[model samples]
Target chain A: MTAASDAPQVRIDGLQYCNWSREIFREMRQGGLTAVHATVGYHEGFRETVRHLVDWRTRFRDNEDLILLARDSGDIERARATNRTAIFLGLQNPMPIEDDIGLIEMLFDLGIRFMQLTYNNQSLLGCGWMEKEDSGVTRMGREAIAEMNRLGMIIDLSHAGERTALEAISLSQRPVVISHANPRWLCDSNRNVSRTVLQALRQQQGLLGLSLYPLHLPNGSDTTLRQFGEMAAEAAQIMGAEHLGIGSDLCQGQPDSVVRWMREGRWTRQAQAAASFPPQPSWFGSNLDFPKVSEGLRSAGFGEAETSFVLGAAWHRFITVSLPSAV
Target chain B: MTAASDAPQVRIDGLQYCNWSREIFREMRQGGLTAVHATVGYHEGFRETVRHLVDWRTRFRDNEDLILLARDSGDIERARATNRTAIFLGLQNPMPIEDDIGLIEMLFDLGIRFMQLTYNNQSLLGCGWMEKEDSGVTRMGREAIAEMNRLGMIIDLSHAGERTALEAISLSQRPVVISHANPRWLCDSNRNVSRTVLQALRQQQGLLGLSLYPLHLPNGSDTTLRQFGEMAAEAAQIMGAEHLGIGSDLCQGQPDSVVRWMREGRWTRQAQAAASFPPQPSWFGSNLDFPKVSEGLRSAGFGEAETSFVLGAAWHRFITVSLPSAV
Candidate 1:
C-alpha cells in the first residue's frame, strides 16, 4: 500500500443510530474510529437529538478521547490529530425541522453537519428513496435546501428520493452527499441510491458513502470487504475517489430494539414490519470495517493513487469542502 | 344539571405521551380517568414498546385499578367495570412497522390497536402535516393501510397530510379517525385537521377527538370547560355526536423533554426546536380526573343524552367498531 493508502485512516461510520446509553458510547470507542457521524434522530425526535449532544458532553466532560462534538472541518481535524473520536451530529430526515425552514439554521448551529433530506419515507422536505412516486423537491423543500446551503450543512441524500436528491444536488451551490448508501446497480435496496442520483450528486461536486450493509450491495449474502472495495471502485469510476468515501452504516452493540427501529418505515414510532431478517445485521459490517478495506484494495489490485483516495483521502476532501476554508 | 351528567362518568385521557413514571400512573389514577391510552410507541420502538407494557404491568400489575395492555374497546369496559384505568397500547406513528407489513399483525397480536399514519412529518403510508408536499399515499403506504385494515387496527390521521389523510379515510374499510384534532376553523394550527379532512373522516364514520390544547381553539386566553365543550358541540353540529370524542392530548406533568419529542418532528429522535415550547403542558388537561368530562358536559349545558354521547359514548362507538365488543 502506498503511503497515502496507509495514512492513518480517520474512520467515519458514515451512518450509525445508537441509543444515548453508556454501552453504545463504549462500542463506538471500541470501533477503532477516529471520527463518526452519529445520527441523533429517529423515533425520539429533535429534543432527544439535543439530549444526545448533552449526553456526549456529560460522558466526555473531561475525557475528550471517548467522544467529542464536531461542528466544523477543524473539529474533525483536531480529533484526527489528537487521536480522538469526533461525533458529528446528523439527522436522517428533516422531520425535526417540522414545517419551519428556520430550524435548518438552528440545528446547523448545533453542530449537525450531515443531514439527509428524509429518513426512510418522507419528512418536511420531500419523499425518501422508499417513496414509490419519488416526489421531487417541493416549494418548501426548496426553501429548506436554500437554508441548508446558506448554513453550509452537508445535504445528505442517502435516504432521500431519487428525484428529490437530484433536485437538491442541482439546487445547492456546495457539494452534497449520499452519506451512507450502496449503488442500485448492485442491489435494488432502498438504501442504495440510483445511478442517476449518483450522477447528479457527482455533477454538483457531492459524495457517495459506499455502505457496508450487504443488503445494499450487489450481494446481500456473504459479501467480503473485497466486494465492498469493488463497489467503491465502481463509484469512483463514476463520481471518482475524491467524491467517494467510506460511509459505513455500522451498528455495533446496538440492541435488537435499535435495529428494529431502523427497519420500521421512516418516521414511525411503532413502525415495524415484524422480524423476518436476522437480528444481528453487522455480519457484513465486519467485512466493511476500515482495516478490511485495505485487504479489499489488494483484491481489486487498485492503483496506489486510487486506493489512497478510497481510504481516508476521499473523506478528507469532503470534510475540507463542507466547512469554510477559513477554518 | 341532568342526573346522567351527575352519574359517575367514565373518563379517559384518550392519548398521553408520558413516561409511565410512578407519578404519572398516580396522576392518571388521580385524574379520575377510568383509563388512558398511554403512548407506548414514541419513546419505545419495539422492545421498549413491550417494556412499557411490562412496566405498566409492574407499576399497576396487582393494583387492579390500573389495567395494563388494554388494546381495544373491551379493555375500557373491563377497566370501568373493575375500577381500573385501562391502559391502551397505541403508536403515535407507524415507524415501528419499519419496512415489513406482516409486523402489523404481530403488533396487533401484542395489542397495539390505534396507530397514527404519520408522525409530525412522514411515514411509509404518506406525508405528514409537516411534509412540504401532500403526495397522498405511496405504494407502501397503501399496503400499510390495507394491512391495518385487514388486521382491524384503528387508523389515525391526526398527523397526516391534508391529501393523505383524506385519501386514507377514503381507502380505509374500517372507520379511521383523528384521535386528536380541532376544527381548522377553530384555530389555524397545522395540528388542526382541516374541515375537508374532518368531513372525510366523518363521511367514513370516523371519529374526531376534541383536543384540549387551547391553541387549537379560538378561546386560548379565556379557555374554560365551556369553551372546550362548545368546540366539541360545534364538532357535533358538523359531524354529529357519534363522530365526536375527546383526545384531550392531555399532557399533564409531562416534562419539557417529552413535549420537545412531540413537536420535534417525526424524522428524528427529537427536533432542534425541542424545548421551544412550554415546560408543563398541564394548562390543558383533565384536571378533575378522567371523569372531568362529566363536569365539562354539565358546565356546557349539555343535556343527558348529549352529555353521555360526548363524554364517553363517542369513544364507546369508536372502540366497539375498532376493538372487540367488550369496550
Candidate 2:
C-alpha cells in the first residue's frame, strides 16, 4: 500500500471509464491522484445520461471517504486536502444533450464540465474521427461551442474529426481541450490528434492529455515506459510542455460488452466481430502506477517542473480557468 | 382589432397551458400581457419535458413577432418594449426532474422559472391537493427547495396539498408562489389556497396569483367578473395587495383529453369518467379579455395602482427577484 506521499505532485488522469468500485477508489487514493475526469456518457441520450448521474451520486454517497464529485478546481483542492480523489464528470459524445441546445447549460448545472464534440462517429455537433466525410462544425456545433464557452464547460476534441477539431479550436473563445488523445504522428490512428490540430491547440493555449490506452500508443500494449516518455517529449516539443497531461484512457475491470456498446451503440445493426478493451502498458496498468509515469518522464529528460506539469499541474491550472464558480 | 393600448400597465398571467396558435398569440397581444408563465409539463418526465421545450422553441421561432421566451425581468421588459408577450416556461408537477435533485437546475437552465411541488396527486416532492392523506414536503423536497433558492427558480405550490404548501412556504429560503389558486374561503375547494397558507405567504412576502379556472370559482361558469373581483379583493386582504396577481389557468383551445391527462397521468388504474375542460366565465374566455378583468377590478374599488399590480406588476416584481441570470 505504498503511495506517492514522497512528493507533493498533483496527479490527474484527464479521462477514465472504469467499472468503478471501492477497490478502484482506494487505488486512486494510493496513487495520490488529485482528480480524474470520468466519462459518464458515450451514446446515451438525456434520460440515460441522468441514470449515470444517479449512479455517480450513489457512488459518491458510498465512497465519501475516498472520492468526491469535482465541480470546480476548489473541489479538487478540497479532495486533495481530504486525501481523496476528485471525480469530474464528462461526456465522450453529445447525445446527452440530445437535440436541445438548452441542455448544454442544463448538463453544466448538473456538474458535467467536459463534453466531447463527438465520440468515434458523427454527432449532431461535429464529425467524429471515424466519419468518411468531415463536415467540420455543424450549425448546432457552433452554437454548442459558444454556449459551452459562456457556461465555462470544457469542449473536448479528443474523438472529433480533424476539420471539426480545428474549427472548434478556432471558434471557441476560450481554449478547448483534446482530453484523451495522442499525436497522429506517433500512433497514426484516426482517433489520434493531427499536427494541424496540435498546432492550433498550441496557438490557442489549449491542452492535450496524452492517452495511455494501447490503441493510442505507438506500439499497442507493448508500449514501453521509454516509448511513452519519448512520445511525451515529442508532444511537448510540438505543443509546449505547459499544455500536456496524462489522460489514461483506463477501462479497468470492464467487460468486453461495454467496449462493444461504446463502439456500436444502436447506431448500426451489424455487430463488430471482436470488441474487447485493449490491455494497458505493463508499467501503467492502474491508478497505483502513476509514479512510474513520473519516473518515465524524468528518464525522458524532463525537468522536475515539466514532469509535474505533464502529470497534473497543467490540468489543475487549465480546469481552474475553464470552469465558472457555479452554473 | 382594438386592444388594451389605452393603458400601459404591465399585465402578466401567472399560469397558462393553452393550445398554442397564431390566433392565441394575437389574443395575447390584444390583452397587452407583458408576460405569461406557461406550463410546459404536467406529468411529463425529463425527456418529455424536453420535447415540450422543443415545441415551445418552435412556437417561439414561428411567432417571434408575438412572443419571446422570458428568462428574467429583462426579458419581460424586452417583450413589453417590443409589444410582444414573454412566455415563461413552468411545470404544474415535479415529474420533469424525476427523483434527481440535479434536474432542478437543469430545467431552470432550460428556462423553466416556475415548478409546482405536486400536481393533482402525490409526487416525490409532496402531496397534491387531490390526495386523501396529505404528506408535507418530503426529504427530496427540502433539498429541492434549497437548490431552487440557490438557482433562483420559483417554488410554485398551486396544486399542492395544504400541508405541502405550508411546509414549502416555511422551508423555502426565497418567496414561494401559489401561481394559480383561488382563496379556499371563496371556493371551498382543496385546490384553492387556504387562509393559513395565504397568511404564511404574506408573512414570507410571497405572491398568490388567483385562479380563474371555473372549478376554483364560486359558481363555476356562472361566476361573474364582479365575483372574481371580490375573490381577488379578499385574497389581497389575506395576502398583501402587492402579492396578488392573476393566474387565469386558461386552457384555451385544449381538448378534453388534455384535462384528462392532467388529472390522471399514469397515476391510477381506474379511468376518470368525466374529462372535459370546464366552461370559462363569459367575460374572461381568452387572453383578449384581460382588459375586462382590469375593468372589473376597478369596479370592485381596486385603485388604479392596485389594479395594475394585480394585472401584472406583482408577478413582474416577484419574478425579477426570483430567477438567476444564467445556469
The number of the candidate with the highest lDDT is: 2
Native-to-model Cα distance after best TM-score fit, residue A127 in candidate 2, in Å: 5.1
Q: Once superposed on the true structure, which residue ranges of model 1 sit more than 4 Å away at CA?
A: A1-7, A19-32, A265-288, A325-327, B1-327
Tens-place lDDT per residue, model 1, A1-327, is: 896446566566666654445555555556556677777776455445545544555566555656677777677667767766777788877766666565565456555787778777766677777677877888888887887877788788887777788788888888887878888887777668777888888888887877765467676656666776677777777888767777766655566666676668344567566433332323434312455565676677677666656655677678777765322
lDDT of 2 at B102: 77
Query: RMSD in Å for candidate 1, one decimal?
Result: 21.3
RMSD vs true structure, all candidates: 21.3, 6.8
lDDT per prediction?
0.69, 0.89
Q: How well is candidate 1 docked (DockQ)?
A: 0.01
Residue range B126-147, candidate 1, lDDT tens digits: 8888778789988988898888
**Looking at model 2, how many pairs of residues clash?**
1
**Native contacts recovered by model 1:** 0.00
When just chain B is superposed on the true chain B, each candidate scores a TM-score of: 0.87, 0.96
Q: B107 in model 2: Cα distance from truth in Å?
A: 3.5
lDDT of 2 at A198: 95
